[model samples]
Target chain A: MVLHIMADALFISVAILTIGSAIVALETRELVYGAIGLAISMMGIAGFFLLLDSPFVAMFQITVYVGAVAVLVIFTVMLVRTQALFSIKEDPRRKTAGIVLLLVFIGGIGAVVLASGLGNPAFTKFNKPAIDVATIGKQMVTYYAPVLVLLGLTLAASVIGALALARREDIEQKNERVD
Target chain B: MATVPEEFRFGNFLASIIWVILIVIVLLTLVILPLTFIVLFYVPLPPVNGEVLTPYLFLTMIVDPTRTLPIVKYLIHTTPFKVIVFPGFVFAAIIAAATIFVERKFLAKMQLRVGPLYAGVWGVGEGILQLAADGLKVISKEILIPSGADKPIFWAAPIAFVATAAAVVALIPVAPGWVVSNTDVGLIAVFAILGFFPLIALLFSWASNSKYPFIGGLRALHQMIAFEIPFILSALSVVILAGSLNLTHIATSQHPFWFILFLPISAFVFFISSLAELERVPFDLPEAESEIVAGWLTETSGMIYGLIQLGSYLKVYALAALFVILFLGGWSGPQIFPHQLGPPDAIPLVKVLTLQGLYNAVTVNAIFWFLVKTIVIIMLMLLPRGISPRIRIDILLHTGWYKLIVLAFVNMFVALALIYAGVLGPGGSLSIH
Candidate 1:
């Protein structure tokens, strides 16, 4: 009983943190603060993953999001110093469009929920088996093997493309110098 | 001390303090006291000795001589004790600080100079106090900020770096069942925490809002990301051999033969990648002083610089410990601890030293071998700091991306070969278990 209550408390607190930080990310004035807020929000989601007992996915999320994506965002924001980004003038057209889009998203979700009737108050006890990485690996190879190969190939192709593009830039610069 | 001008009389200040105290007293009595009582009523108290204990009972237990055994056992097994003392921040910090002093002395020997002189210990010139002295110097120095620097990030990044390093330390098992969080995926969690270092470096450099910092940050990003593949790949070879991601399992799997004998290439790859990851010499291009004025860390000074360097050394210790855990048998050695320190029944609570005492004996033995291996690895890590100059960026990237990755792959194949040949596996012909 104590464990259940503690888990519930932890879950609620983590959910609040995720929403609060995400709101801060959107509403903050400073770009760097926004980026920090985003990182915090991502971490809160990782905490949620931990609560869900998917530690591997949680670690992967942290490694990719808080470690790489946030840094990439910071780098881009630092490098690109465009004056237009400093002063975001509100347009009536854009404001109306945003509100309409938000309403549509909300209405669609509400409609789907009402149609499906997912509000039955039945609770099922969670008794998950202890699943380890080997199980996940075996399933990935047997069931999703083609999808795994597809991802690998796509990543390899993109890497080759990026390298070629970089090489081309170097050659073009050299050609310009010679001319 | 600077005197405050007596624009207003001291009597007025004294009267204001009295009013504040009066308000606080009223607030505590009217609001806070009832709230505390309500909370105490709602919360369930844990039972002890067939009695629901209160604060009064706890106080008496503190003075009780016979209660020491249970108290000692609880303290030893507690999370805070493990995290703060053994195999955690304080332990890692002491090792890191010692590394700094010993590294200075070692490099000094290599260069024929007096290193960390005058900061001697009792009857020894080991620079035992040098790290503390340097810490004081850094703390006392002024912190300077660039004009357009992102102040919040500039301050937070170094702290985050240290926290992440400490998080990695928390996962390392110094002995069996002796970790802060004994998660099954401890090894992967270490890699995940380690991934934060590059982000911290980049963020701090970007936060500096200076040209040199920007260049340095980019180099750090490239350097860290490039080496990560080889790092994971090399670790993959070990995972294949052990068939487990738990650091403890990996260690125990190596009882029959250390993984290095069968997977030397992976160990080499792991070592090189770790050196790169730790940003040690010959791979310290991100912070090369000659070309980039200490690279991404150019703008850091005072305590900020101190924190980053401390974090770096902690990482050094962590990686060295990991190397020991993976390639060398972690905490495994011939049992050298005496069967009993004295007559087991001498102690009242422990007739024959008790379960706790026996566990402690084993733990001490494990810690001894673990430290021996870790220190040797640390010395090896520090060797290149004196021997080699930092390499160029192109060569560093090429080696990280191409050579190390290929070597790691080759070892992965070798691991697969061993497993299939039934030479060593979970229940193979020559299984370690």
Candidate 2:
């Protein structure tokens, strides 16, 4: 009973942290602070993964999202050479439209949850064992091989494109005026 | 101020006292009580020795030594013991301190210079207590914050760096079944935790709000990201050779033949990448004191600098432990440990104090070998600090991005070829399992 109650408390706290950080990330004016909020949100998602018994995914999420992705965002923000950021006020009509869209998305999520009967332990207790990393690798290779190959190709192409884009732009010496 | 003191006699003092009392009473009765009740409702009480182990009884358990043995044993398996004591932060910290001392003395001998001659209290013990003296000096100094710095991040970044390092240490296995947070993905968790250091470094630099720190932070980011791919790739070869992602399983798989012999190229790649990731001698451009005034760490003062240094050393211990576990055939050696110390139930005091039954043959031996291998790896890591000069940033990045990746890939292919030829792995003749 104690374990179950503790588990519930853990879940509630993680849920609150995730939502709070997401809101902070969206609402903050400081670009760096917003990036920190995003990192915290990523950590909360990692906690959820731990609760779901997917340790590998949780660790991977932390490494990739909080470690690499958020750092990249912060690096770019810092490169802009500014401390304080000024946000432009949006029109009332745009605000109203955004609120309506958010409400619709929440309503759709609630409807899906009600229809799926999610949270019934018996309903999702088929295997009941943690998926080992070896099986994950095997499944990825055997069943999801094509998608993995496609991702590899896309990544390779992106690297090439980035290199090309970063190459120094050349102009004719005759066309340029000497300072 | 003088007028207030003159006017404010017992009358004003009594009024303030009454107000303080009222506020404390209201806060305790209204806020604390409800919060306590909420916590009690959400978490059930744990039972200890056929009782709920109430707060009042907690003190009683410490006195009755016989009754306390079970509770003590219980606490040993708990998270606190694992996190704070054995195989965790404290253990790693001690190792880190030792490494600092040894690196100084060893490098001194290598250069014919007397290093740390008189550090503490008139130079007793030949400067052996130098790290302690340095630590005390740092503690005594004032931590200065720049006027334009981000106060919150500047204060929090060093602590965050240390916490991240400790978190990584939690995932490493010291001996069989003796880890703090054992999971199926221990190795991956280490990598994930490692990814945080670059972010923390950049955050600290940005918080300082200085031109030099900005340049240092960029160098750190480039260095860290460039090396991470090669680090992952080299580790992948080990995973392929062992056929397991669990660090403990990988260690056990290398019983008779260490993976270093078969995957030397991968080992070489891992070492080079490790040096870069740690920002050691040959790859320490980010914090190059001569060129960039300690790089990103230029603005850190007093205890903050101490904390960052401690965190880096903790990382050194962790990475050394990982290398030991992966390639040095962790905890495996000749069969020398006894199966049992004596006949079962022969001595009651031994059972109660030493917990003899818990001390199995394989566990003790494994711990011994694991420590032996880890120390050797740490020494190897420290050697380059004395031998090599720091390389240029562009050259360091180029080697990390290009050469190391190719070398790691070549080793991976070699591992695959060995597996296909049936030299090792599952169902092969040399399979340990």
For every candidate structure, what is the RMSD over all alpha carbons to the true structure, in angstroms? 5.9, 7.3
Candidate 1 docking DockQ:
0.56
Global CA lDDT of candidate 2, please?
0.87
- Fraction of the reference Cα-Cα interface contacts (below 8 Å) that each candidate reproduces: 0.65, 1.00
Q: List TM-scores for all candidates, in order.
A: 0.86, 0.85
Query: What lDDT score is found at residue B422 in candidate 1?
Result: 87
Error of 2 at B172 (Å): 0.9
In the range B1-433, model 2's lDDT, one tens digit per residue, is 4556546688879999999999999999999988976665656756775787665555576665545776766677788899999889999999998888888988998999988887646647668889999899999999999889999999999999999999988888988888888778888888998999999999999999898887888889999999999999999999998998888888889887999999999898998888888988889888998889998999999999999999999999999899988888877877587887766665566555655545568877888888888999999999987888899888998999899999999999999998999988997678755
Best by lDDT: 2
Q: Which model scores highest in DockQ?
A: 2
Candidate 1 residue-wise lDDT, A1-179, digit = tens: 99999999999999999999998998787777788789889999999999988888898889899878987886676667646685867789998999899999999999998777566544345487667878888989999999999999999999999988777677789999999
Give me the runs in candidate 1 sitting further than 4 Å from their true place: A27-30, A86-88, A110-123, A163-179, B1-67, B121-123, B347-359
